[model samples]
Structures are given as C-alpha cells and as structure tokens.
Target chain A: MAGAIAGALAVFFVLSVYLLPQSYLGSIHPTRPGPIVTDVKLSQTQVVLGESFSLQVSATNSGEHADMQILSIAFPSLSSTDGIVDVQKHDFRQTPLFIKKDRAIGAGYTAQRLVPAQYPSIEASNRPWNSGETFSIELSIKPQTEGEFVIFVKAVGLPHNGDQAHWPSNGTIDHQDEFVSVYSVNVTKA
Target chain B: MNYQRGSLARMQESRRLVIGYTLVSAGILLAASGGTWDVTNHLLNKPETFFAPPHAVLYTGVASALAGMALVVSASRAAGQFDWSAKFLIAGVALLLSAGPVDFVWHSTFGLDGLLSPPHSVLVSGMVTSSIAAIIGLVRASKVLPAALIVVAILPVWISAAGAVHMFSLPFSNTAYFNFNPHPIAGAIVATLGFPLITAAISHTSSELTGRKFGILSATAAIFLFINTFTSIIPNEALVSTIPFYIATVIPFVVADAILARWRSPKSLYMAGAIVGITFFMLYYPLITHTYNKVMDNKTVWGSLTAIIYFELMGPLYPVLLAPAAAMGILGAMIGQGMVRRAILAGLR
Candidate 1:
C-alpha cells in the first residue's frame, strides 16, 4: 500500500509540474482568440550576389478583438526549419516569429545558414501594430556568399491590455504569417 | 566506537558518498550539457517545446540529481546522520524540475526573456541551491576528488549565470547581437559572487588546497566548460565558427596560483578572491578583444569597426568591472566559510 501510494504521488507531482502552468497561464492569455495572419513580401525574388533588397511585413486581425496591441516585430529563429521556406509552409511555430537570432544578415539567409548572419531585427518600433492596420518596414541586405535564402519575419506584442502579456483581447494570435512572399537570392561568384 | 565499528562506519560513509557522487555527477553532466544544447537549439530557432530532445536531456539530468540526493538522504538517515545539506539538495532539485513546465507557461502567457528570466531564475537557483547543498555533503565527507568532479560537472551553470546577467544588461553591451562578448562586466560580477564561495568550500573540504589547488580547479573547470561549449557550437558550424573560449578562461586560474601563493586565513581569502577576479579579466581582455575585433567584420551588423569601437568604449571598465569582482569574491569567501562551518555542524562530516 505504501509503495503504491508513493508511485501515485510521484506521478501526481510530475503531472502537476507540467500541467499546472498551462492551465493557470492559459487562463490568462489563452492562446489569442482565433487565427490571426501575418504577411510578408519581397521587393524582388531573384537577386545577384552582394545585392541589396527590401522585405515588407504586414498584419491583419481576423479575430473579434478590435484593439490588439503588437509589441515587437522580429526576424525568424535560428533553426533550419525556421528559414523563409519553412515559415511559409507553416513548419515553424509562430511564437518565435519574433526570433532572438542576431541581426547579422540584414535581409535573410537560407535554412542551412550557409551565410554568416540571420535577418536583421525590425527597426525600433514606430508604433504598436493595431487592428486592420497594414504597417511595413524596409530592410537592407548584403549577401557575402552565394546561395538561395529564405528570410523569416514576425511581430510580437501585448493585446488590448496594453503592456499586459496576456490581456486576452478575445482574439487569437496567428504566430505564422497568413501569407508570405518568399524570394530566392542567388549570390553569384563576384 | 570499536575498531570493527569504526571500519563498518567508514564503509557506510564511503558507500553513501560514492552513490551520492555518481548520481549528482551524472545529473549535473546531463543538465549542463543539455542546457548548452538547448540554448544552441534555441539559438538556431528551435521552438521551445516541452518535449524537445534537449529539454529531455536537461530533465533527465535533473531527475538523476534528484534521485541521487534522495539516496544520499536515505543513507544519511539510516546512519543517524540526517544531513541538512542533502535534504536541501533533494528539495531544491524538486523545485528546479518543477520550473520547467512553468517556464513554458511563462513564455506562452507573457513572452520569453531568452535569458535567465524570472521563471528561469527559479530553475537556476534550484540547481545552485541543490548543487551547493550536494557539494556541502561531499565536502563534509572530505572527498576532495569527487567534490571536484561535481564542481566540474556543473561548471556550465556558472557560465549560464554569467550569460543570464548579460541578458539583463544594457542594450549597448549586446551590440554584437551575441549573448556574450569579450568584456562581460555583469557576468564578471556574478562570477565573482559564485566562484569565490566554491573555492572557499573546496579549501575547507580539502584543507591544504587553498593555493595551487584553487588555480588547478579553475583550470580544470575552464577546460571542461570549454569542451562542452565548443561541442554545443559544433552543430552550428555552417552558421559561424567560434574562438576557443576555454583558453582565455583557464589562463587566469593558472596564473592566479602564483600570485596568491602566500595568502591564507579567512580574511586573506578575500584578497585571494580579488586576485582571482582581477586575473580573469587581465588574461581575458587581450585574448578576446583583439581576436574578435579582427574576426567580426561586415559579416556582422556591428561590423569590425563598430564592434571594436564598442570594445574601446568598454575598455575603461577593466578596473571598473574588476573592482566589483574582487568585492564579490571577498563576500563569497566570507559566506562560503560560514556555510562550510554550518555544513560541518549539520552532520555532513
């Protein structure tokens, strides 16, 4: 009886550790309301090595909430699956759409990281992305090595709560962009 | 105690120490390596999933450490030596492991600091408390070598602490868009606070080891961390190659041995700590600044010139950073001595 009780307690503690937070914090932010969409577009898809380009980012609120506040706009993460191709295919998570990856590469690079740097960070926030707003930023890119690259972009911010992490605007956040325009830059032998 | 009884007691002590050491060592090894791996994956844009492989590795380490501490407590209880340090370790491991899922929730609810954020601090503190408690047990038993092994196993936690404090630092300090750099003053302060305590504890446990042994410990720890960190960076080979950090880390400890050879006594430990802190910066500066300045050209957003410019801006901090390091070192030594005394009294010996 004692042994059985011990085993049960062990299981309970482990489960409690893993599940408690989800339920508790989930109550607060509750994975935004429904599917929100982020969109990305490239000025031109094909470019030569060492050439410069621009990427345009926009967001649309599909959920019921009308006043969601977006905090930061960031580049994709540092994973193979986080490159432009994977992001468009919905292979990577939406949360990292605000990547912690360095702004070494201005425009973007491939999933393989053949280039040295990742995409640069979004320039300092001009303003929080609001509902039904189509805001964009222009970034410059110079590729040292030649390869086809996919750039990842994302925006992260609080909701109607304004600075409150999970103010629950009753609208779900779309971690992935609803539509992404992926362009391949081929760096030629200079 | 009769001779036979003494022999039996010694055997039991040996048995307890071995079991505890094995478990904790295995735990720390996994936890540290898994931590580095997880960060690397995080760096690579691997989403922070609860069941990710690196997370598993880290949890395994935590579980193993927990199990080890449990066994140690059990053994101590059986022997009528209810070691409080062992008990604290057990409790701390439980708390540390619990923080994992909580961390995920924190991210989902708020966002990730990607550093030693609040929830993450709970995890780091749990490990530190448990580790120090376990180390106390080892030191109490007077097992110098096994104790050293434990320190080496968990050395990365210290490095992580350094990185976490850096993450909390000013944005200008992170201009390279890297987590760490040539001059990590905040990290140095954290290191000063932690390493001195560890050194003082080792001295108490080993008795004759305050001088050469201290430096040797640093050298060994640097090598282990170096290898582990280098291994973690290997998978990102296509992204960017890293310089050998262990070289810079180990140099100071080796040099500090001679600098503080004549120092002893508890108060002098403060000076000894100050020496260690200063030595680390003195050796670390040229090694990282000059090399990284040349290596990080236009390939980086900061560019070589900008990176060097920032490096120069922080250059005057050589004395500034080292001063606090020395103060923290002294404070660590003083606290370590107090803790060591408590550990001994708590029946750890």
Candidate 2:
C-alpha cells in the first residue's frame, strides 16, 4: 500500500512537471488605442522676417477605430502676449487639444483646410475636429527686429475611441517639434 | 518534591518556548508585511487596486500576524514538548504560500494587463525558505504532529491546482499562466507539499537503515528532488510550467503520508530534513537575485557546496543538492534539526 501510494504520487509529480511546459495558460488581451495626431508639417524651413509661413496641421484616424470628439489640435499661442512668436521661440506648450466631432468637417469624412497664422482669429478654440481625417492651417511669421528667429510647429490629438488619449494637449508629447527659421532680409537701395 | 521540580522545569521550558516563538513570529511578520508592501509596489502597475482605502492592507497584515501568533501559542500549549522553532518554521511557510494567492486574486480582480508581470523575487525567496523550514520542522517534530502538518500542507496544493486550472480555462485568459510566470500562491502550495514528502521519504529510508522512524526526513528529501526535477525540465522563460510541478509536488506528499502512517526516530528524521533543506537552499541561491544580472550568478555556489558537504559527510556527492533549490531545502532542514536536537537534549537532561 505504501509503495503503491508513493508510486502514484511519483507519477503525478512527473505528470505535473510535464504539464508545466504547456503554453497559453495565462494570456491577457490587448488594449485599444488611446489617441493620435498626424500630418504635422512646416511649409518652409527658412523664411524672411515679417513674411508668411504656413504650418499645415491635421488630425487623423490612425487608431483601430474612429473615435468621436478627439481633441486633435490646438494652437494655444494665438492667445499669448507674444502670441505665436513666443511659441516659436520656446516651442508650443503641449496642451490637450479638445476634439468635438459633432461639428463635422466638410464631407464628414476628411477635415482639411488652411488658416492664416498671422491673424489671432485662427485659434484652436475656432477649430474642433475628429480623427480618421486631416486638416491644415497656415501661419504668418513677423520677426520684430530679428537677427534669427525660430518658430515651432506642433500637432496633438487622440483617437476617436473612448480610451484615454495618449497625447496631452498641454505639453509637448514626447518633445516632438518642428522649427521654422526666420532670417531678416535687408532691402538696401541697390 | 519531584512533581514540584518537574513543574518548575516545565515552566522554564515553556518560557523559553514563548521567547523563541515571539522572536521568530516577529521576524516573519516583519518580513512578510514589509516584503508584501515592497512586492505590491514593484510588481503591480496599479497598486492602488489592492493597497487603496477600503481594503486596508495594514489590517490584513495585523490579522495575519495575530493568526500566526495564535497558532504558535496553541501548538506550544497543546504539546508539552512542542518545538516552538518548528511551529515558527511552519507558520513562515504558510505565510509564504498565502502571499502567492493574495497577489494572484488582487491582479485578477483589478484588470491588470500582465498576469505575471514584474515577478516578486523577495516573495519567491520567502516561499522557498519558509518551505524548507516547514519540512525541517515536520521531520524533527513528533509523529502525530508531522502527520497533521502533512494534511494541512496538502489542502493548499489541491486548492492552488484547481484555481490554476480554472484560471487557465477562463473565457478571457490572461498571460499569467505562461511558463516562468511567478504565481506566488501556487509556488507556495507546491513548496508546502513537495518539501514535506521528500523529507519524509528520506527520513523513512534512513530510519529503516538505522532501525528508526524518520518519515519527515523522507518527505523533505522527496520534495527537494521533485523541485530540482521540475527546475531541470522547465526553464525560467516558461511561466506556465509551474502548474504541473505544483500538482506533482502535492500528490506525492499526500500519498507518502497515507502510506507511511507515522514517522519514527525524530533524530534521524531531522537529519534527513536538514540534508534536504540545506541542499535546496544552496541550489536556489543562484536564482534568488532580484535582477537577472548574468555577471553575478551564484547557482554553482550551492552545487559546489553540496558536492563538498555530501563528500565529507556521506563519502559521496549524494547529488541531492544538485537539484534546483535542493540546497535551500537541505540548509533549512539542517537548521531545524539542529534546533530540535538541542531541545531534545535539554529535555533529556
């Protein structure tokens, strides 16, 4: 009886060890995408002081599914004392861009357009967008008495899905930024 | 006059037991409470789920400590010659095993992504060390006590295996069941079951050779061997492999207890426990590091020590500690046996 018991136990032990290598016992499912911003570009690398430079910023549906009201882009510098110029100098503070898809852009599929950056009216408050699409806006640079001026281009947004947005609008998301240089062009009586 | 003298001696013995129990219990409680907190912080991505307000981890900790103290006091009171050291050792093992399930349930309920992410190395060490201690204690204790302890040890294994199987078959299975996954609770149960059986088997065999009973020793030795075998078969990367190993360890201990009926010859039994305990400790030392830093690996330390110890003691390598965690098992058993021998000698004098 003792031998039989020991033998049975030994068999079980061996069997358990054998089964230890079996995979797929504890697996976790993947999570949905949070948020995304896309197609952020500067029109020109070097521009004459007081000349207009375009920044084409857009929001897109880069996630697995289209999310609603994903605050894709915001231009906080438009309201600053130095306005867009201060933002260009120190890089735009990445703030959370609010997206409200209820105000559908154009065809309700893609939202693409250019705004004059020189005017304060072209601000994030005026633009509400959704993801799975794109939009562009132009900015005008005016260097006060420029030796060399740098302007920043930034885009931020989240997926339309209800998942928390990965990119925050209030700060530089992972410090990604686009810089535009403004050189003062002298127009002497030549 | 003789009765008065005997009562005085018993009083002194009881006082000593109480001191031993208090010290050991305090140390274990401190370690478990501190270690669990550290483990929760390091292992859990969202520790708030378990450590946050309503749950009150501190209350649970206090309760566990009180339970441990109560068990120790009860054991000492019930058995006039109850080895307090052994009780502490068993309690430590119980704590180690319980920690695993607590962590598992916490993770499962919280929707944590990785089921076995960021393994708690300290918790693992505690479980391993506690198990060795428990086996050593069982081997050195009286026949009835060891038998009772074995039954207690078996319960966790059955529950853990069932839980693991259920978790594995869940509709939404997580990645926790993978091989090399650190499931503290399951590991605890496996250690509890395996160490006792191995120690008992070794004790029994040694008793037969010396004309005595040593069931605990045989059980401890068997568990060490089983752990070593399990380690050899499953690499650290294979997290899921532990489930079967756990099942394997539990079944043998239960079977051995049923067959052996009683362990005789406390000294020989303790010797077996010590050998298995120390061997397991040495074997697992290399794998005990918190970080998987290859530069400072020390698995061979125990293996070499085992070879030397066995050669010097038994005129052969014995190959017991050559198994995974065998060094720890042997070391703990030795420590336990040493304590038991002292107690026995004191009782005799």
Candidate 3:
C-alpha cells in the first residue's frame, strides 16, 4: 500500500511539472505585438541658419490589430540632447499625427504625415501602425546658430489599453527608442 | 479498558489540544510573516510602489494562525466524535484554489489600487488546502489522502522551479520572444510565495512515507537540492528579471523550512538546522561579499550574482557541498528515529 502511494505521488509530481508552462486558462486577449519604425528623412540635407527645414519620418504597422489612440509623435526642445535647428516659432501649430483617431487601418497598411513649415521644433512621436501601414512625420526646423549640427527625432507608441489619463502614462510610457538622425548641416553666412 | 471519562481526562486532553494548536499556529504565523515580509519588501522597491502596512501583516499573521488553529481543533473534535466532515475539507480546498485566478484578475486589472490583496491566491490556497487536508487526515488518523494532496500541491512548484533553471542556459538570441519584460513586484511575489508552500507540503508528507526515518531524510535532502538549484540561478545583484525565481522559489522554501524545522515538532530540527547553518555559512556568507564587490564594481553581473553563486556552489564540478548536504540529511533521519525511540522509552519508564 505504501509503495503504491509513493509511486502515485511520484507520478503526480512528474505530471505537475510538465503542466507548469501551459498558459493560464482564461487570458482575455492574445498579446499584440507593438509597432515598428522603418525609415526617416529631412526635407533638406543641410539648411541655412535661421531658415526653416522639414523632417520626414516613416513608420510601418508591424503589429496585428489596428491601434487607435496610440500617440507616436515627440516634439524637440532646444534643451534636448539632440542639438536644435532654428525655425520660425508658432505657438498654435498642431504637430503631425502618426496614428489616425478612431480609424483602424487594416493589417499591412502604411500612413504618412507632413508637419507645416510654421511649426518651430522637430516633432518626434509614434503611434500604433497596422501590420503594413507605413507612416511618416515631417518637422520644420530653424537653426538659431550653426556649426556642424545633428537633429534627433524620436517616436514612441503608447499601447491602446494603457492608462493614458494617469500622470506618467500620458507621456511616452514604454520609452521604446525608435529614433532617426539627420545629417550634419552647416549654416553659412548669407 | 473503558477509556477514563472525567474532568481530569478532559483537562489533559484539552491541554494536549492547546499545545498542538499553539505549535501549528506559531509555525503557520512565522511562515506567513516571513514570507509576506520578504515578498512585500521586494514589491515596494519595484515600479509598483504599493505598500501594505505593518499592521496588515500583524492582522494576516494573527488571522491565519487563528484560522489554522480552528481547523485543527475542529478536526480533533470531529475525530473524537467519529464524524469526519468532508464538506468542510472540500470547502477549504475550493477556497484555496479560487484565490489564484481571483487575485490575478484583481491585480492585473486594478493594479496596486487593490490594496489588502491577499498573497498570491495560488499559494495561499495551496497552503490552506494542504493544511486543512493535513488536519483532516490527523483527525481520521488516515494518512494516505493528505499525503496525496501535499504531493498535488508540490507538483507545479517543482516544475516551475526546474523550468526557471532551464531559462538561464537558453541562448540570448531568443530574448525577444522569451523575455517577459515583467514588472519587479509581480516577479518577486510569484517566487517568494510559491516555494515555501512546496517545501512545507513536502515536510508534512515526509512523515507518511513507508520508511518514515528515510523519508524524512530524503525530503530534507531534496529541499536542499532544490535550494541549491535556486541559489545557483538567482543573479547576485537584484534585477526584476531574477526576482521571479528568487521570490517564488528560493526565499520561501529555504526560509520556511528553516522556521518550520526550528519551531515545529520537526522529526529532525537539529539536523536540519545544522545542514542549513553550514550551507549558509559556507555558500551564502562568503558569496555575500563577492556579490557586493560584483555589484559595486560590475553592475552588469550584479543582478546575475545569484546565478553565479548557484553555479559556483552546486555546478557539476563541486561535489563537496552536495555530498555533505545529502549525508547530513540521512544522518538527521537516523537521529530523528533515535529521538522517537527515546521518547517512547521515557514514557514507558
């Protein structure tokens, strides 16, 4: 009897170990993969100091579902680690939108955006892109002073399910560093 | 021999019951307190800054102890009455099993906003179910089913522990898919909560084995081996990645076993203590300084220090520690048998 009990226990132990990796029974939704950044470009390779130039960034929907309300754009500051390019300052110029609101782009779709030249800093942001949607953003820059300079553009996507109303979640929550770098520009005296 | 029935007999019986209740209560309380403290400390440091007050700990400690004692008392009285309540036992088990998913949903949806969240539902449930089952078995003086329940509770833990070990050697190229990107507190709670229940269950069932003496030794040795396996993998410096393994498996099992053996009527507390004491001094004490140096000088490996220590102490090449740990376990069992024999003799005298 004791031997039978021990043997039974041994078998149960073996079986239990085998079953540990099985996913919990009732997970609500399949985990969706996040968006991917593909390519980025600036309107001009080099710009004159105090003159405005545009930055164009492209992203593709690398994930399965159409992500609505995913914030993908970042605005550059002079204080940013990436050196600033001078452009005319406009207070109310809306930044380019990376993801369309209330729109579900089918899998494998691409989207693009062009920020008007009136906006002062390079805009950096990211949003959820459907599997094939290639999206881009263009930022207008004005260089205050120029030596050889590089401007950095960063785009991040917040998950649709994430709590955006909360303080820290409203900003780039994941800190996914999908970045683009522009070539060195020399502002020559006009 | 009409079993004497009177106030004197009842008083003696009640005294025995009180002592038994006290021992079990103390054991469960200490285990719960240590487990919760270790888990919460890790939790507060994580990105989730949820804090359970010290008073909460006291409440849970006292509550669990009282609950455990009540079950034991009921079981004892039921045994005396020859009326075993399987419904009560089943209800307790059901309660334990329900806790895991309930808490998972509550936490994942509500986050730390769900304060006073019970310890991981699975662990609490497993512990309570197993404890209740043990009490039932003691009442009926039927050993087999309680042993079976214990074995059932231990299965997932061992499997998870082994899987966690396998994760280290997995090539980093697979990190994209395999990496959980887990929050630190979630990882810590999983580890700290699971392992103690596994160890305690094993300790409880050791008594039911055919060669009770040998069974105790084997269980103790197995626990040590599991701990060695854990310490080998846990990175020295704390990282959220390693927290899952340390909290879920290592701390709970080692700490619980240490406390349970110390305070309970363990078959061989002294022997268990000696092995644990030596293992700590030789393996962990020296490794602490090594870990500190690694953390201060090389931050990258600091989180990996637990794994490094585990490999150093128990990897294939080092038989010295493993050999003694196993030997001491066997010797402890023999000593335990002698102690039981002596007690029986003293009673006869």
Give the candidate number with the greatest TM-score.
1
Better-scoring candidate (DockQ), 1 or 2 = 2
TM-scores, each model vs. reference: 0.52, 0.35, 0.32
User: Could you tell me which 10 consecutive residues in candidate 2 chain A have the lowest summed lDDT?
Assistant: A174-183
Residues B1-349 of candidate 2 have per-residue lDDT tens digits of 9999877766564544444333333333334333333322322112244555323533454344345445555556655545645555555555555666766765576534332332233244443344334333433433333343442332222222222322222121234343443343444334433443334333333323222333543444355335433332222212222334333444543443343344444443443443333332222221221111111221211111222221132112223323433444344444434544554454344
DockQ each candidate and list the results.
0.03, 0.14, 0.05
Put the candidates in DockQ order, highest first: 2, 3, 1
Which stretches of model 2 miss by more than 4 angstroms? Answer: A23-190, B1-34, B37-41, B48-248, B252-335
Model 2 achieves a DockQ score of 0.14
lDDT of 3 by residue, A7-52 (tens): 5434432332222112111112322434444665566766676676
Please identify model 1 stretches exceeding 4 Å from their true place: A1-190, B1-10, B44-53, B111-113, B142-215, B224-228, B231-246, B259-271, B279-314, B333-349
lDDT of 2 at B35: 36
Give the Å shift of residue B18 in candidate 2: 4.8
Which prediction has the highest lDDT against the true structure? Answer: 1
Q: After superposition, how far is residue A26 of candidate 2 from its true place, in Å?
A: 11
User: Candidate 1 or 3, higher DockQ?
Assistant: 3
TM-score per model for chain B alone?
0.68, 0.34, 0.34
lDDT of 1 by residue, B220-298 (tens): 4465445454544453432122233223344434333333344455555565455444433322322223222333221
| Quality of model 1 by C-alpha lDDT | 0.46
